[model samples]
Structure formats: structure tokens, C-alpha cells
Target: MLQTMIMTIVAIPLVLGMAAALGRSRLPAPAFALLLPLFAAVVSIGIEGMPAFPPVRAAHKFPYVLAAGGFVFALVAWRMRVVAPALAAIGAAIAIGLPAWWMGANILAGNSVKATTVAILAVLAIVGAFVAAARKAETPDGAHLLPQAIFATSLASALVAITGGYMGMAMFNGGLAALAGGYLLVSYVSHIRGNAQALALGGVGAFAFAWVAFMGLVATALLAPKASMAGLIAVGLTLPAAPLAAIVANRLTHFPAALRPLINGLIAAVPALAGILIAGLQFAG
Candidate 1:
């Protein structure tokens, strides 16, 4: 466990430094976002060995596929511009639901009419939340929303992994958290200099991608019969917490603009802590 934790800790700064450099490169926003998952994959493989692929069976390989697909869909949505939300909804449903289906989740397999209905409704809910979060982050007033959301999701993912006994996944998520943290730090610096628009705009893709991919991960947890339900619920709560933080922070006329991201980070941390606590209990048991 100590070794695992050390590996996760070390991977974050490495990935963060690399991602920060990429963000500084002035690559098109969508292009930059598209590359995040690849970095995540490299980190995942570096720590966990190559994720089982192809004939290795979907059960073992789905994580890698889901992670990659989520980012790809975000790239597609960014390229679609005005149609991004609709496209993202479709992409998210497929990216998230398909993995559940592969995992033999009754909710996604359409085993019965009622099950199928519930599955569709659940997928729609996730899609709605995802699109809403992405759209909210895109707004000028909510510019910091996406980075905070990504941070929250990554944090929750790491917690979930610990509870679920997926040390590799924990490391992967820790790397993601570091990347998001680094991005947020860079973004805050840019904001201070009045040069944040480029990073913020480019972040739309990364944010959207992280949103969907994390949703898929949550679904993966929810479907696992032995997974910690408390942990999953905690993760779900963090999803909207991102946009909610933005909304609340926006209304705080008395708060300094420079400190808004700090406020956002605090808001995002609430659910993340809850998830860690619940998951830790399960781990302890």
C-alpha cells in the first residue's frame, strides 16, 4: 500500500508538469483536451501495466477503452461547436452505458422491459448532468467551473478506487487530479495577468472529456455488485457540486475574484471528502 501510494504521488507531478507544458504550448484548445486521456493512458499503463486489450476480454479492458472514448467524445463535441451539447449527450450515453453493458449490468443490458426503462432514465440523468456541467463551465461567469469539476471528479475517482480495491485505478485518478490541479494553478495565474481566455477556452474540451469519462467510471462502480454504494453516491454528489460551486461563487459579490477558484475548490472538496470517508470505512471493514 505504501508503494502504491508513493507511485501515485510521484506520477501526479510528472503528469502535471507535462500537461502544464502542453497547455503553455498554445495548441488549439480541443487538441490539447484530446491529448489529456492519452497522457492518462500512459500514466495508467506505466503504473498498472498495459490494460488488457482486444481479445483480452472487455471485462478487463473496458477501463482503458472507456477512458479513451470519453476523451475522444469530448474532442468530437468541441469540434461540433453549437451542436456540442447534443453530440456530447449522445457520446456520453454510449461511452458510459456501453461499459456497463460490457460489465453485464442489468441496468444496461436490457434484460427486461422495466430494467431497460430504468437504464435509459439513469443514462439520461447522467447525460443531463454531464451536459449541464459542461455548458455551465463554458459560460464566462463560470470560467473556473470546469477545472474545479475535473478536480472534484478526479479526487472522487481516487477515493472510489481505494475503497473498491483498485489500486491501479486509484493511481490513475491521482494522476488525473494532479493534472487538473496543475491546470487550475496555471489558469489562476493566467487569470491574474488577464490572459486566461485561451487556457479557459481550451479547457472546455478537457473539462467535457473529464466529465463524461468520470461519469463512465462512476457507472462502472455503480454496476459492480460488490462496489461500495456509499462511495458511488458520494461521487455522484460531486458531479453537480462543480456547477453549484460556480453558481454560488458567482453570487458572492463580496468575494474577491482572485479567490473564487479557492472557493470553488473548497466546495468541490466537500463531496470528495465524503467519498473518501465512506470508501475508507469499507476498506477498513
Candidate 2:
């Protein structure tokens, strides 16, 4: 477990930092929103090793889903100047639904209705998250607020997975949270340093992979028999927490600009913490 924490959470500085550095220098667009975290996620998955191709098991398909999400989101953002959340949701439905059906073929054959319902809910949840994340810089109080919210989402997801009896899923979410935290760290520093890159990542500029990966992760987990679906939904409340926090913080007028991101994250953590506690209670017996 310590090793898992090290690889997933602690490695953020080294893994994600290096990825961000590369994006700044080598990449033409220099956007870390999708590629950087995706890179971190892929590296973190190394803890479990590479997932098998043409995954026969539904659980084996996360890596592929993450990659596809990364590509689809990146492409959509690049091609279209602006994308409606509904359109993105539909695209997500296709991108994620196909794989859910494809990889869970054998297991979900008889549970088609269940799988479809879960897929719908997953898409809805993803849209909610996208819409919320879209408001990242709406107030300009917290540039890192978006990624910090993402960290909360993933960390809360890890808690849900833990109570659901899915250790692998827990670690996966933990890694994602860690990677997002890395982004948050860098964003904080850049914001303080007054770098151009600070505001670049401010909105959903490079969030192609996160939404895609989110749909895949939630839908896949919800489909699992042992999954704590209710708990996960409760955890989903964290989706809007960041933006809402930002709004409230924005109203404060005197709130320190430099501390805005941290404030938003701390506020969002409330719901996530509540979700964790609720999930823990569910398994208390």
C-alpha cells in the first residue's frame, strides 16, 4: 500500500512535473490538461502493469478507455472552437458506451438493461462535471480550482471503491487524484510566478482526457456487482463543489487572489469528505 501511494500520489512531482516540462518545451500546443495527466495516469497504471489488449474482462479495459478519452477530448477541443456540454455528453455516450458493451460482453450480456442505465447515468454525471469544470475561470478567483476539483472527484472515487471491495479501482482513482494534485501544485506555483502558462490551463483548455476517463471510470465501477453505486453518486456531489465554492468565494471581494484556488479546493473537499465518511459507514458493518 505504501508503494502504491508512492507510485500513484508521491510520484506526481517527478512524473507529472516532467510531463508538464515536456509539454511546455516540446509540444506545439503546450497544453497539459489532457496529455500531461493522461501521461501520469498511464504511468501510474504501471503499478498494476499494462492491461491486456482486447480485454476479455471488463476490468481490463480501463487503460484503453483512458487513452480513447484522451484522444477524443483532445481532438474535439482542437477541432471545435466551442463545444456544448450536451454534444460532449453525446460524444461521451458513444466513446464510453461502446467500450462498456464491448469489453463487458460476456458478463453484461444478460444485464444489458443494467448496463445501459448505468451508461446513461455515467454520461449525465460526466456532463455535470464538464459543465462545472467549464466554470473554472468564470470568476478568475482560482485558476487551479478546476484541477483541484478533479483531484477531489478522483480521491472521493477512491474512497467509494475502497468500500466497494475494489482495491484495484481504488488505486486507479488514487493515481488519478495524485496526478491532478500534481497539476494543482504546478498551477499554484505558476499562478504565483505570474507566468503565461498559469492562465492557459485556466478553464477546460486541455481537459480532453479527464471527462472521457471519468465516464469510463464511473460507468465501469458502477457496473461491478460489488461497487457502491449509491456512495459513488454521493461522491459525485463533489463535481459542482469547486465551481460553487468559487462563486461564493468570488462574492467575498476581500478573498486573497493567490489563495482563491486553495480556498475553492478546501471548500470542495467538504462534500468529498462527507462522501468518504458516508461510504465508510456503509461498510462499517
Candidate 3:
């Protein structure tokens, strides 16, 4: 418990810092952001010993991970733009996914029904986050949808992993929280550079919703056994609420002047209603 608490504490602040930096800074946030993960990777390599670079090793399939991300930054530099989040995000996706595939596939393969389902969900979350980050990085003009999606999907996967009896739930959950918080902090950095108010609000909303998702997971764990099917249903519906929050944030907070309140309302309302009904079922059961 003490260790978990410490991790949570460290993760939250770090994530918040990263998120804040990403959103507001006119300077090279990606390069700055790269420092932390790069340092981490270096530390990991020191401890693990330098395995050949991914491209050189047969075991490492996503060899171009860094290259793809590096390319984005290079593109930006050539054009004389600030290093973008899209570059780091693309790099991060490759970094996380390749390792996860190599490591996680085995665990996922030897599972019972519930465990297998949870494993699939977790893998999807990891992959989805990668995709979302890449998408957001690639298209900065629009409201950043991918980061939020990544956060949401990651949260859901963590919840499912914890509730479904995965052994590494504590670490997974802690990581999810950190990643989500980081996404928000990064947006704050964007906000500092004169980003729209809605964008910042959207960042905050997504951050808050991530915690709410975490709480739902806790609730599911404690209450689920008593109302298995209903709890599952509640959790199932709640799983997508993060994406809805993102959509609403994007539409309401960051969309063009014309589409603001109307689309946001629709996006927010539907999931809320769905969550409410599902919660009712959990209670009823």
C-alpha cells in the first residue's frame, strides 16, 4: 500500500507537469517532454543492458518507432516550427506498444474467459492510446481528440485489468492515472501559448473524467460481485464515457465558432444518460 501510494503521488505530479508543459509552451515542448522518457529509457537500458536497437534485433518488430517520431520532429525543424506533441506521441506509441506486444502476448495467451477478455481490453487500450496520440500529433489544428481518447482507453483497460483479476492492476492503474494526467498537463502547455479557453477546459474535463473512471473501477471491484451482470453492464457503459467527454470537449470547447454548444450538449448528454441507466441497473441488481 505504501509503495502504491508513493507511485500514485509521483505519477500524478509528473503527469500534471508534462500535460501543463505540452499545452501552453510556445517553446519546444516535445523536446522538453522527451527528456523525461528519454532519461527513463536510458535508465532502463542501463539496468537491462543495451539490447540491440529495435531495428537491429529480430525480437524488436517496431524498429522504426523512434525513427517515425524523430521524422516528425525533423519535419517540424526543417519547416522551422516548434517541436510538436505529435512527434513525441508517435514515438511514445511505438515505444510502449512494441514492448507491450513482446511482453504481454504471453500473459494474454494463457488466460481464462474473464482474464482473456480483460487482456484483450488492456492490449486494445495500450494500442488505442498509441494510435490516438499519433493522430493528435499529426493533426494539431483540430481539437486534440487522440490524447483524450488515449487517456480514456488506457483508463478503461486499467479498470478492466484490475477488476478482472490481473495481478499487475496496481501498477497498471497507477500508470494509467499518470498517463492521463500527463495528457492534461501537456494541454495546459498548449493553453499557455494562447490556445482557446475551450481547449484548456477540455483538458481539465478529460483529466477529471479520468479520475471518475478510476473511481468507477473501484466501485466495480467492491460492488460487482454482488451484482455481477448489472455491474458489468454499468462498467461496460461507463467505459466509453471518457471518449464522450473528449468529444464534448472537442466540440464545445475547441470546435469552430458555429458548432459549439449544440454538438457538445449532444455528446455529453447521451453518455451521461447511458451511465445513469447502467448505474441504476447495478444498484437494482
Candidate 4:
């Protein structure tokens, strides 16, 4: 168990931090970020040995989504010098929505109400993620909101997934949260302080990684034998926390400029912590 934590939690963030630093360097930025999500995916595999070759379980299929999603978004990032809203929206929908369908289709098949409800919520999540990533504050202080959002969401999801009846996915989400934190820390130096392109976190590749991985975790968790929809929904409240943070932070005009990002991060964490608590209560009940 300790070994698993070292590999899945500790080592992953260290590797991701290095990767984010290198990706932000002068050497063809987008290429270095192409496999960023795969870093977390490998740790996930470490938590639970490689899925069957044929992948008989719906959850096993997530590896392919992570790989394909990261690569596709990397290409999009490589080509898109600027994140065109329409194109980002389309990419996010395909990357996030398609994977959700792939994992949840069978799981949600028996209940039309669940299927429709999840479908609508999934759409909202995709749109919210896109808008959050696209939003810009007058200062670079807001540059980290998307990463903060991703980190908070993944952390809350990890706690919720365990109680929601998916320990493997929970471990995987824990690794994911680590990766986001690493990305944020390293990219802060490269992008925020140095004023480089957001190749590591805020860019198209990073946002794609964040949304794809988080949604994939949720979709795959839904396939768990005893998955709880309420827990999943509770953790999902963190999905919109980033933009909400922005809105809330804007209302407080007196904070120091340098402290804005941290303040926004704390705001996002509120919903995340609340989600975890709500999910925990649901699980206990």
C-alpha cells in the first residue's frame, strides 16, 4: 500500500512537475505536452494493473480515451496558436462527451431518467470547462484558475469515488489530482512568472487533459458494480467551481494582485470540500 502511494501519488507529481517545466521551455512546447495526461494514466495503471488486453470491463477502456484524448488535444494545441472558442468547444465535446458515452452507455442503459439526466449534466460540464479555460482576467493572477479547478475537482472526486464504490478509480483520481498540482506548481514558474505560453496547464492541451481525465473518471466510476449517482453528482459540483471562483473573486476588489490566484483557488476549494463532505454523508447513509 505504501509502495502504491509512492508510485501513484508521489512519483507521479514529481514526474509531472518535471514534464511541465520542460514543456514550458523553448523546445517546441506543444510536443512536450502531448503525453502529459498519459503520465497520470500510467500511474493509474500502477494503482490497478494493466487492464485486460481485450478490456472486458467498461472501465478498462479508459486507457484508450486518455491516450487518444491527450494526443488529439496536443495536436489541437500545436495547431491552435490561439484557443478559438468554437474549436475548443468542439474538441472538448468530442473528447469529454464521447468518452462519457463510451463508458456510461451500458451502465446507464436501464434507466432513461439517469441516462438523460447524466447526458444533460455531462453537456453542462463540458461547456463549463471550456468557458472556464477560455476566461481571462486582466491580470496573469487568474491564469491558474483552470488548473486550480482541475486539481480541486480531481481531489474531491478521489474521495467521492471511494465511497461511491470505485476504489480503483478513486486511487486513479488521487493520482490525477497530484498531476494537476504538479502541473500548476511547475507551470506557475514557466507560464505565470516567466510569461510563457500556457503550454503546461492553461493551454488547450492542459484543459483537454483536465476535462478528459476528470469526466473519464466519472464515467468509468459509474460502471462500478455499486456506483452511487448521488455521490458522483456531489463531487461534480466542483466542476463549475473555477468560474464561480472567478465571479466571487471579482466581487472582492480589495485583495492584493499577487494574492488573487490563491484567493480564487481557495474559493474553488470550498465547493470541492463541500462536495467531498456531501459525498461522504451519502456514503455513510
Candidate 1 lDDT by residue in tens digits, 1-285: 777656655555455534654565666555655566555555555565665646254345545654566477456646654445665566557755665555555444544542443354346446655556457345554555656666777777776776676665566667677766667666777776776452343334644445543743454364333446666566656655555665765676586767766775677567767877887788788
Top TM-score prediction, candidate number: 4
Clashing pairs in 2: none
For candidate 2, give the lDDT: 0.59
The CA lDDT at 66 in model 4 is 72
Model 2 — which ten-residue stretch has the worst lDDT? 196-205
> How many clashing residue pairs are found in candidate 2?
0
lDDT of 3 by residue, 177-282 (tens): 4555565555544445566442432222232232233332332332222323332333333333434455445534456543442343344334334434554454
Candidate 4: where is the Cα deviation over 4 Å? 27-29, 111-117, 133-139, 187-201, 225-228, 250-260
Residue 14 of model 4, lDDT score: 63
- Rank by lDDT, highest first: 4, 2, 1, 3
TM-score of 1: 0.74
Q: Quote each prediction's TM-score.
A: 0.74, 0.79, 0.42, 0.82
Number of the top-ranking candidate, with lDDT as the measure: 4
C-alpha lDDT of residue 100 in model 3: 39
lDDT for 266 (candidate 4): 78
